[model samples]
Target chain A: MLQIENVYKTFNPGTINEKKALRGINLTLNPGDFVTVIGGNGAGKSTLLNMITGVYSVDSGKIIIDGVDVTKMPDYKRAKYFGRVFQDPMMGTAADMQIEENLALALRRGKKPTLRPGITAKERIRFKELLSMLDLGLEDRLTSKVGLLSGGQRQAITLLMATLENPKLLMLDEHTAALDPQTAAKVLSITDKLVTSGNITTLMITHNMRDAIHYGNRLIMMNNGEIVFDVSGEEKKSLTVDGLIKKFSETSKGMLSDRTLLSD
Target chain B: MIEFIQSLPSPIAQGMIWGLMAIGVYITYKILDFADLTVDGSLGTGGAVLVVLTTQFNVNIYLALVAAFAAGCLAGFVTGILHTKFGIPAILSGILTQLALYSINLGIMSGRANTTISWRNYKLIVSSKTDELFFTILKLIVIVGAIIAVLYWFFGTEIGRSIRATGCNQNMSRANGINTDTTKIIGLVISNGIVAVSGGLLSQFSGSADVNMGRGAIVIGLAAVIIGEVVFGKLFNNFVLRLMSVVFGGIIYYIVIALVLKLGLNSNNLKLFSAAFVAVFLAIPYWKTKMAVKQPASKDKKTVSQKEVKGNAAN
Candidate 1:
């Protein structure tokens, strides 16, 4: 479970470009809760995730993950409690490192790095099994550097890496945003499969309104640095994309623009 | 040609000593992707520490060498702090450390510009003072081989892999819970430590450690690394062999210098020649890639093929 209590964040305060990124934001997730987050640009969806992952400092209030207070922990230190995938595929995996090596790094997340051999034979066998599940023909290429893979393949490997050790919480910040439509759909299916099977508590931020409704047991909507809508269970299942868009317009000053990048 | 052949032995010996420094350079340049200039200062710091300890304090020569490595580590540590903690740029941090080391090296030698240690008096490791060229080269070869073996093993360890990950992609490393800042400092420490060891050996080889001994040391290290990549990069993909290639590059570089000197080139222009040599080799890969990608609209396949070739190199 994860908890954010009345957290607030401001960027470059007092400057002309200063912006309030988060405002008295408070949200909590139960164990195995799959929460889909939807918001337009500057809606603070990504900012909230970053705060939980410790990428952004919580200006006020606290972040508690699984009973551990991590409000002040740095990003790398807080990594032990969570697995994260970024919007940019390149940001989630080391290109020059071998596939197995990247997996090994993820496997040891939150653990102390030691003088022992990084990838033993036993770990390699497990890595192969895990890679084979992705069905990307990456199992046989365990030793191959990740840079050779396409963006979609890299993102798949990154997803595998995040779930390698069954992290306390999984956070995805528009992880499929950079992929083509087909690849994005494929990745989304894999994500759905992983989260459902693993029963992972997740916070997934998406620009696609349909996806926000299609996936996850619970859904939250954000606008102007605050959560304005929340729904779950039967109610969340019944909500359609058009209904949600109309709801967003009623509660907020602006409309939820179409998911296309060309939209204002 | 006979004269050049006769002069080969000394340059070969010089090359082996310089080769160790090149391996250290490889750690920072090729592995960490950090162009650490700390080697420039750490080399002198190593030489100064060794010479001062051996001659003034009557410390054991081998112990003095260890001290030299620690001294180099300290210099690298300072640079790492400047870069990571103080928010200085990588190149500037190295430059600052190298500049500060000038004063530190002078202080280590008790304000003396140069200090001499005689093989005749002290039990030196390997030296030019002796006429036993074959044994000296043999000893240095073993040392170089041992260093390479050690490095190969170290890089296979968990901590070492984390360091490599940090260099390749900092975001991924941090996300995976590796302390990139700590790994970076550790890398700088190891690199400068090895460079210092070579500096100490160089001082012992020539029977003297001078304040100016490490001048343009980075360029020479880079030259050796670039030469290694240009010559043996394709031939040897294994980590251990790649390190050996760096040493061989140093030898080949020295051999070329010997030949160039024989062909009526003045020693005064040696630095210029080295600079020019490094510049050309460094540009070759960039130029080759540029040409490969500079095709017309009809040559999409050519570009893909070139990219695949480059990708294959990653393995």
Candidate 2:
């Protein structure tokens, strides 16, 4: 479970570029809650995720994960409780390291690294099995540098890494946006399977309206640093893309074009 | 030609000693992806510590070397703290540490710019004054070999892998809960420690530790790394073999310098030559990417170009 209380974040305060990224935002997620977030550009969706992950400190707020207040924690320390996938495919893995090495690092998340062997013989076998499950032929290339992998393959591997230690909260920030449509679909399916099987609490940000509606048990629409709509259960399941667009237009008063949301 | 041949042994010995320094540079430059300028001062710190301990304190030669290594580690620790804790840029942090070490090295030499230890009175490990060139060469080789072996093993460990990951992708490392700042500091410490050891060895071989001994140490180390990668990179794919290539690169660099000196070039111009050599080699990959972009035929080529640009931006 995760809780955000009265979170406020402002970038470049008192300057020409001053902008309030988040303003008094509050949200909570129950155990095993799968939430999809949708918003136009600059909706503070990514900022909200960043706040939770401690990538950016909230100006005035508290972030509690699993009953521990981590608002003051550094990004790396906060990472112990969360599995995160970035929008950039290249951001989630060390390119020069081997496939198995990346996985081994992921397995040691929230644990101290010691002088032990980086990847043991037994761990290698387990990693090969895990890679084979992705069906990307990465099992055969355990020692191959991660930079050589395709974007889709890297995202899939990143997804696996996020769940390797079974995180308290899984955060996906447009993780599949960089891939082609077919590749994106494949990675999204992998994401669905992993999140469901592990019963992980997830907060996913997506720009595509169809995907926003297609996945997750609950959906929230954000605009101008605030959540404008929250729908769940049967209401979320029965919602259509057109209806969501109509609701967004009415709520934001046509400040953003529907073309941005309708492109997908 | 006979003169060049006769002088080959000395250059080879000096090269082997500097090869150790080059290996240290390789850790920060290639592995940690940091252009740490701390080596220029730390190398002198090593020699100063060794000379002070051996000549003034009358410590054992081996103990002097150990003291020198520890001194180098301390120097690197200062730089690491400056960069990580104080939020200074990596290059500036190194420069600041290097500037501080200059005075420290002088103080270690009892307010002198140079210190000499006589081989006749002191039990020396390796020296150019000794007539046994073969033995000196053999001893230096053994030391370099041991260092390379230790480093090869260290880089394969879990902590070492994390350091490598920290260099390659700080974002990924942090997401995986790695304290990247700690890893960077550790890397600088290890690198500077090795560099100091090399400096200590050089001071012993040359019979004195001069204040300006490490004036362009970073350049020579980089030259060795770049030259090694250019010549033997394709042939040596294994980690151990790659380290060896760096040693060989140092030897080759010294041999070339010796040849040029024998051909009547001034020894003072060696630094200029070294700087030019490293500049050219470092530009090769960038030039290759530019050429690839000009071809504009393959999607993979574009990707490589973009990746190179990204890498440049990151650096």
Candidate 3:
């Protein structure tokens, strides 16, 4: 459902800060493929996702989503095809807007906003029902400003927003890294339930090794702007954190520091 | 005190007119989260267009007001294009447009710095010289009320909500598939249009449109917005009521100015006073945040700091 061909991205070329973020990377995903990506810092994992979402243009590559080449598409345009959750909880929702208003905006993704009422009476009822499902008591605070919510609640709302329109691809970029462990687990479980029920195609980037192994049908390890390992099916299911770490150290030429790769 | 009381009506009328411009500023400043400097020039553009159409082309007063509003929109459009399409910073883009409009406004008035329209010869809508103060007040109230009503409805619409979202959180807006560039441009357009209309009304009421009438307009508008929020923000949380409060803020601002003038302050120092007034109010929130940060031992300090961080991100 998504294809990346010979994608190359270099930041600050010809300068002291020059760095090749991606180099001739190519990957393709089949329908309903759930991939978990793991890497150390500066592994180009986020860059790859940013390129796919058109947040940053690839220097030389084509991104095709659902058979349409969207390499040149702007971030907002590509947004219609992808549901994205950012690393920062605050990045995913407008703080000043009400809870229902944010949901209404998500529900209208890929549709043109018009002069009609922003939040309708019927939509409010639907929103309340959806919020209740999160069990966060947000249903009672439909008109409460999103800024008043905690980090975990905001991230949860963001997850709901991402799935509201049943996007073609769901992208999670360390979405729970900022939350406490308990809150992270709750959000991750919510993520699992939504993706499983909807059969949504997803690409999740996680720093935690257990989470990397605990979720998804496939797992890929990236290092130095290249995918070093790709494991799926029974192989991915049987893999343990220790084995994965051994493999990463070997493949990455022992560049995988214990602090960087093994930290949760 | 009696002199101040007698002078109250004139400033009140003028305040209502300036309140229209303040409302326009509120859209960009508060709603769009844009520090648009376009109002300083667009206000003059409105008055110039109105004066040129009414005096030179003999257009109907209402038509002149409409033309002035359109002219202001055009000015804002230029700033929006420069900011969004050319990738200029919004403040720089507004400054560029404001500079350009100065020359355009001059040309519109046929190279004249000031133009006067006689109430005796022209069918004026509202004027300070008119003996019927009741009629003038009623007319100003109706105009401001109609504008507030329209704006209240517009902000509740889908497009309006998107614009608000763009201001509140641009990253979230884009991820939700909103064309933030388009929304921002529309906001500037709407804001400048309303500012121009207020300029038109001011020109009519004061009997003349001066080239420099818009100088420091942004400061005055900000003062009104800050003052309104400071005074009535807690009580007036509803959107429409908040807008009404802005109008009242403008009136209070003018009344304060009138009182100071009555107390024998030099008129030339009014701009300085306005600048100082806005500066103090703008600093209040910052000071509060600083105080919050200082209380590091407090349990709720973390929440306050988080809010501060969020506010920074929104900007």
Tens digit per residue, CA lDDT, model 1, B231-311: 999999889988988898888899999888888899999999999999999999999888776756438877767765553
Query: True interface contacts reproduced by each model, as a fraction?
Result: 0.71, 0.72, 0.72
lDDT of 3 by residue, B134-159 (tens): 67789989988998899888888889
Provide chain B TM-scores across all predictions: 0.93, 0.93, 0.93
What is the TM-score ranking, best to worst? Answer: 3, 2, 1
Off by over 4 Å in 2: B296-315
TM-scores across all candidates?
0.95, 0.96, 0.96
lDDT of 2 at B199: 95
Give the higher-DockQ candidate: 1 or 3: 3
Return whichever of 2 and 3 wins on lDDT: 3
Clashing pairs in 3: none
| Candidate 1: Cα lDDT at A155 | 94
Over the stretch A210-254, how does candidate 2's per-residue lDDT look in tens digits? 898999999999988999999999999999988998899888998
Of 1 and 2, which scores higher on TM-score? 2
The native-contact fraction of candidate 3 is 0.72
